[model samples]
Target: MNEMHHRMARTCMVYTSAALLALLPVTACGDATEDVPTKTVDTSALQPGSYPTEPRNVADRKPANAASIREAIRLAESMPLAMEVDKQYVYNQSSSGKIYAPELPPQQGDSVWVENFGAVIPGLVVGWTSNAQQREDFALGRNIDQTVLRFSNPDQAKHAAKVLSEDNRKDSPAKRDVRIPGHDAAISYVTEQDSVVTWMPHDDLLIYTFVTPGLEVPPDVDYVIGMTKTALDKNIEMLAGYQRTPTDEMPDLAIDTDGLLGRTLPVDDMNKSGATEGVYSPHAALHLRGRADVLKRAFDDAGVDLVADAGARVYRSSDSAAAYRLVAALIDQLDPRYETTDAPAGMPEAKCFKKSDRRSSRFTSIPQFQCLFTNGRYVAVVDAAQIQDLHQKASAQYLLLTDER
Candidate 1:
């Protein structure tokens, strides 16, 4: 028999043995049974085709304000992608629908509005923020944070825009009123360090944009103001396409209409505080990724429209071919600290990587091992501390995807 056949035979033997089963770690292994009697398997009858290639159906659950959350997610898709503001704004830090308090610019005073603004901004239904920077090093590149706040009516939104802008101005004597060209209704100001803050009301939404220059760059009021305008214009144009859920119907907005979240691995409660567990549109997902600019191109090329995040991340592409392209793109974009490694046993299509050194960075966490695998139109990524654990997770994820019931 060939070397490939020999390897498969060995893997089958190990999988079928009760001894190895007992040695396996207590990790997620889909449908893995315990305390099974050892059995002799006919290796000659086994083929690579035995592996699963399709995703199994999973049940969906709804949470409170599920419909409103779903609408916010759709609104996020309409938010200007960082690249649209500027190609250099490539590193997206955060994007979500859970905006409560305004994230003001640096050096801005701690206003009472920062703490009790929610009480004043009535009819606040939902909000989204798309924050990005030119580089991972915050001290070395420009940054832009665009926020969209939705209210029950246009009047309430208009009031919010005015109150938020005035509160910031009143809290800081260093804040000087500024005018944005061609935007008479825009409330803008230049604060210390030359950062620009602008608030504009559009229909039933309040659009807020903040821009800051790199520390090394000299403070240029015009440049910051220009960037603020650009961000506002992009946001306005993108939001024009958004169709908000009617105020009365927001409470009944359905969640997971596409069922992407149901198939994703659920997040651990222990890690819930730090994890963003939900289904997101492609642009919204970019805000949660590293090297988002590069991923945007890959996503566009692969026709990736939906992404689900929890314990593991799942990306839905247009087809098997597109999924493969996305996998390749992801592998190619790995940080320099990682190196390619062997895939899970008997799973040739899966790609795995291991960190090569203990390089520390305040901005990012480096996982010890990461594995990416695909099932039909879906691609999933899982991280683990050990190669063995990674393999087990990959195996379980594969089975989970293939499980039809």
Candidate 2:
């Protein structure tokens, strides 16, 4: 995908519920009764040279604080998902600390200190925002945001938490101190806008949580406190298993350590340098998806350990059977407007879908066509505006995945 299109896909929030799949019909093979036109490609004559087998290597490719940036991405996967706090908070967005300036605070006055604090900016900051309703109408439901700031040591984390709490309390007199149930060191207060904010320092990391109610109800202090507690507890538990990279070894951190990105197809040569195209852990991949809650279970069941996003999204499953199951699960979770039409001509293992006449103003930006296919333990998903283009991309992706070299 191009840079512009990748940005749009990252922020766009239209999603279909997993439960809705029961109402739609899907087929692994083409529907004979459907008159959808398909393009046929000569698979036997396809050459591996037609698609990129390895990611391009740029000279002097290192970015500023590359090690810290990479560690921040790793920390993001350990952060708690919104659904873990409450089932209602199934919608979420993930962000890395690298997005902000390391030496300066965020421009917004009421922003979380984890993004960037006065002289005490953390080595890395990762966050997730979960909502009870769809993005188009999030104001109608509850929302919770969780952020983790990893400092150089326990002392720095404690100092950063202290500085943030003191500064925030002095910023406005309307802020009222609120006591958490079991966290005595936690500094929490209710803002004038009725949102609850909490900052707690644990070991070498600072945990931040913000809870806000929907427009339909008055701010519930008890609900806010309960949710904040749940978020903190879950984060602490998950972090116990995470091993932070040593400060001295961060700069040498490898980008494609497992060679997954090298094997995946790359975008067109002109747009190959985009930052959005990279390999990610299964948990990190959830941040880029719309229905992360539903996909989480599928990812775990299929043992989907790695994901690579380039011209096509590639997933590494445990085995071929798991890959096929993942593809079926993906097709079932597609928006209801998409109907199973046909597989790419001459490729029975592939499955394709096209948007039907059904109209919904909420999902206009979604791609009109998508195709999914598996080659051994790897599953690839490709999208396009035209059926012919989708078929060609699918064929090329299949060849790239099956290449022996």
Candidate 3:
């Protein structure tokens, strides 16, 4: 297999096992029969069983919705998530409301669950199942992750970084050799089962995993992962993810060393810099950022909020940069219940705003971008049109208004 595939496989194996181990007790409940058998089974010793496809009873299944998404994830999270037997029923819900059965159905229904343990090297996915109910535990393609956006939370990547750091201190090998495919070397760490982990690699952040098994990772997952392979790609991807590409040609400016003290990137100049629009719509970014207050002002000021802020910070004096940094620092402040990370592969908390038609800031949601200010600070912006049913021409004013000396 390719490097990324190998890395992903290995990394997934380690973390998946760890995560499964973590959830074992929770899924066991208090019932003695519910306890997971610790018996090891050699995968080679067991014969592969043929799985009969189970017919989908769409009528019995719950219709997909925000609530259903929640329940699916909850069920996946709470199960004694381990593959114990060589054979089991692997059921999946089709887009057309049919349940596709696994090649082998070990067991069925709510009593059955998947596991990740196998004999002889203990391969990746192992679990159990039964066939009475239609609730697909690991249904892919559902918008379950969308539900996670609610309830102010910490970025999973940052949490991974912290875990890596701690593991490094303890001399963990996983921390030293983790890589992010073609992107950068990552400091891989474990997270709750079926979650993502990340790390910082210089100016660019590299995320290692987004563990959503049995679910098709949103196209964005591959898009983000593939594009983040290079520094140029990362810069453009970050901007594009926010839908803020420069519409015009390049700009010319001089090196401003004074603006970049103790900051993330300290470039010599931005002369002859080009511009391009984001891959996603500004409106999409607003919804993704998901902060009502910041969303309001950012969407209104879509075009300039992120770019202008970055430009200004790129040109700001030291005092201004320092002050802005202080505020920027608070963007991803941690919560006792909402643990976040500040290291590589993680995003920091940020104050956000939206733009009005007149270049003034307002409360709206839609156009979104991250502000990199002249004072060396970062803020977030969202699209206005997405905030409501209203639609208007969102003219992002400058390709790059440079200081032409």
Identify the leading candidate in terms of TM-score: 1
Q: Return the TM-score for each candidate structure.
A: 0.73, 0.69, 0.20
The candidate that wins on lDDT is 1
How big is the positional error of residue 342 in model 3, measured in Å on the Cα after superposition? 46
Q: What's the best-to-worst order under lDDT? A: 1, 2, 3
Better of 1 and 3 by TM-score: 1
Task: Put down candidate 3 lDDT per residue, 287-387, tens digits, no spaces.
Answer: 22122223223233222222111111221212322323323332332111222212111112223333334432211222332222221122222122232
Over 1-405, each residue of candidate 2 has an lDDT whose tens digit, in order, gives 222232233334332111112111232235422322234345674434355544445214544534444666677677666766676666543221112224223433223542345445554342232223234334455666666777778777677777776666554333578988878878888876666778898988888776765564567777778888888899899878778888777667775646666556555542212233456687766655445667777787668899877567888988776777777778776666788877776677578889888875343245678888777788888877788777777777776676453
lDDT of 1 by residue, 139-199 (tens): 5777776778787888988898788776666444335889888677788887766777778
Score candidate 3 by TM-score against the native.
0.20
Runs of candidate 2 exceeding 4 Å displacement: 1-51, 54-66, 94-137, 154-175, 214-216, 267-278, 336-349, 352-369, 384-396
Q: Rank the candidates by TM-score, best first.
A: 1, 2, 3
For residue 399, model 3's alpha carbon misses the true position, in angstroms, by 35
Misplaced by over 4 Å in model 3 are 1-178, 189-196, 204-211, 216-236, 239-285, 289-405
On lDDT, who's better, 1 or 2?
Answer: 1
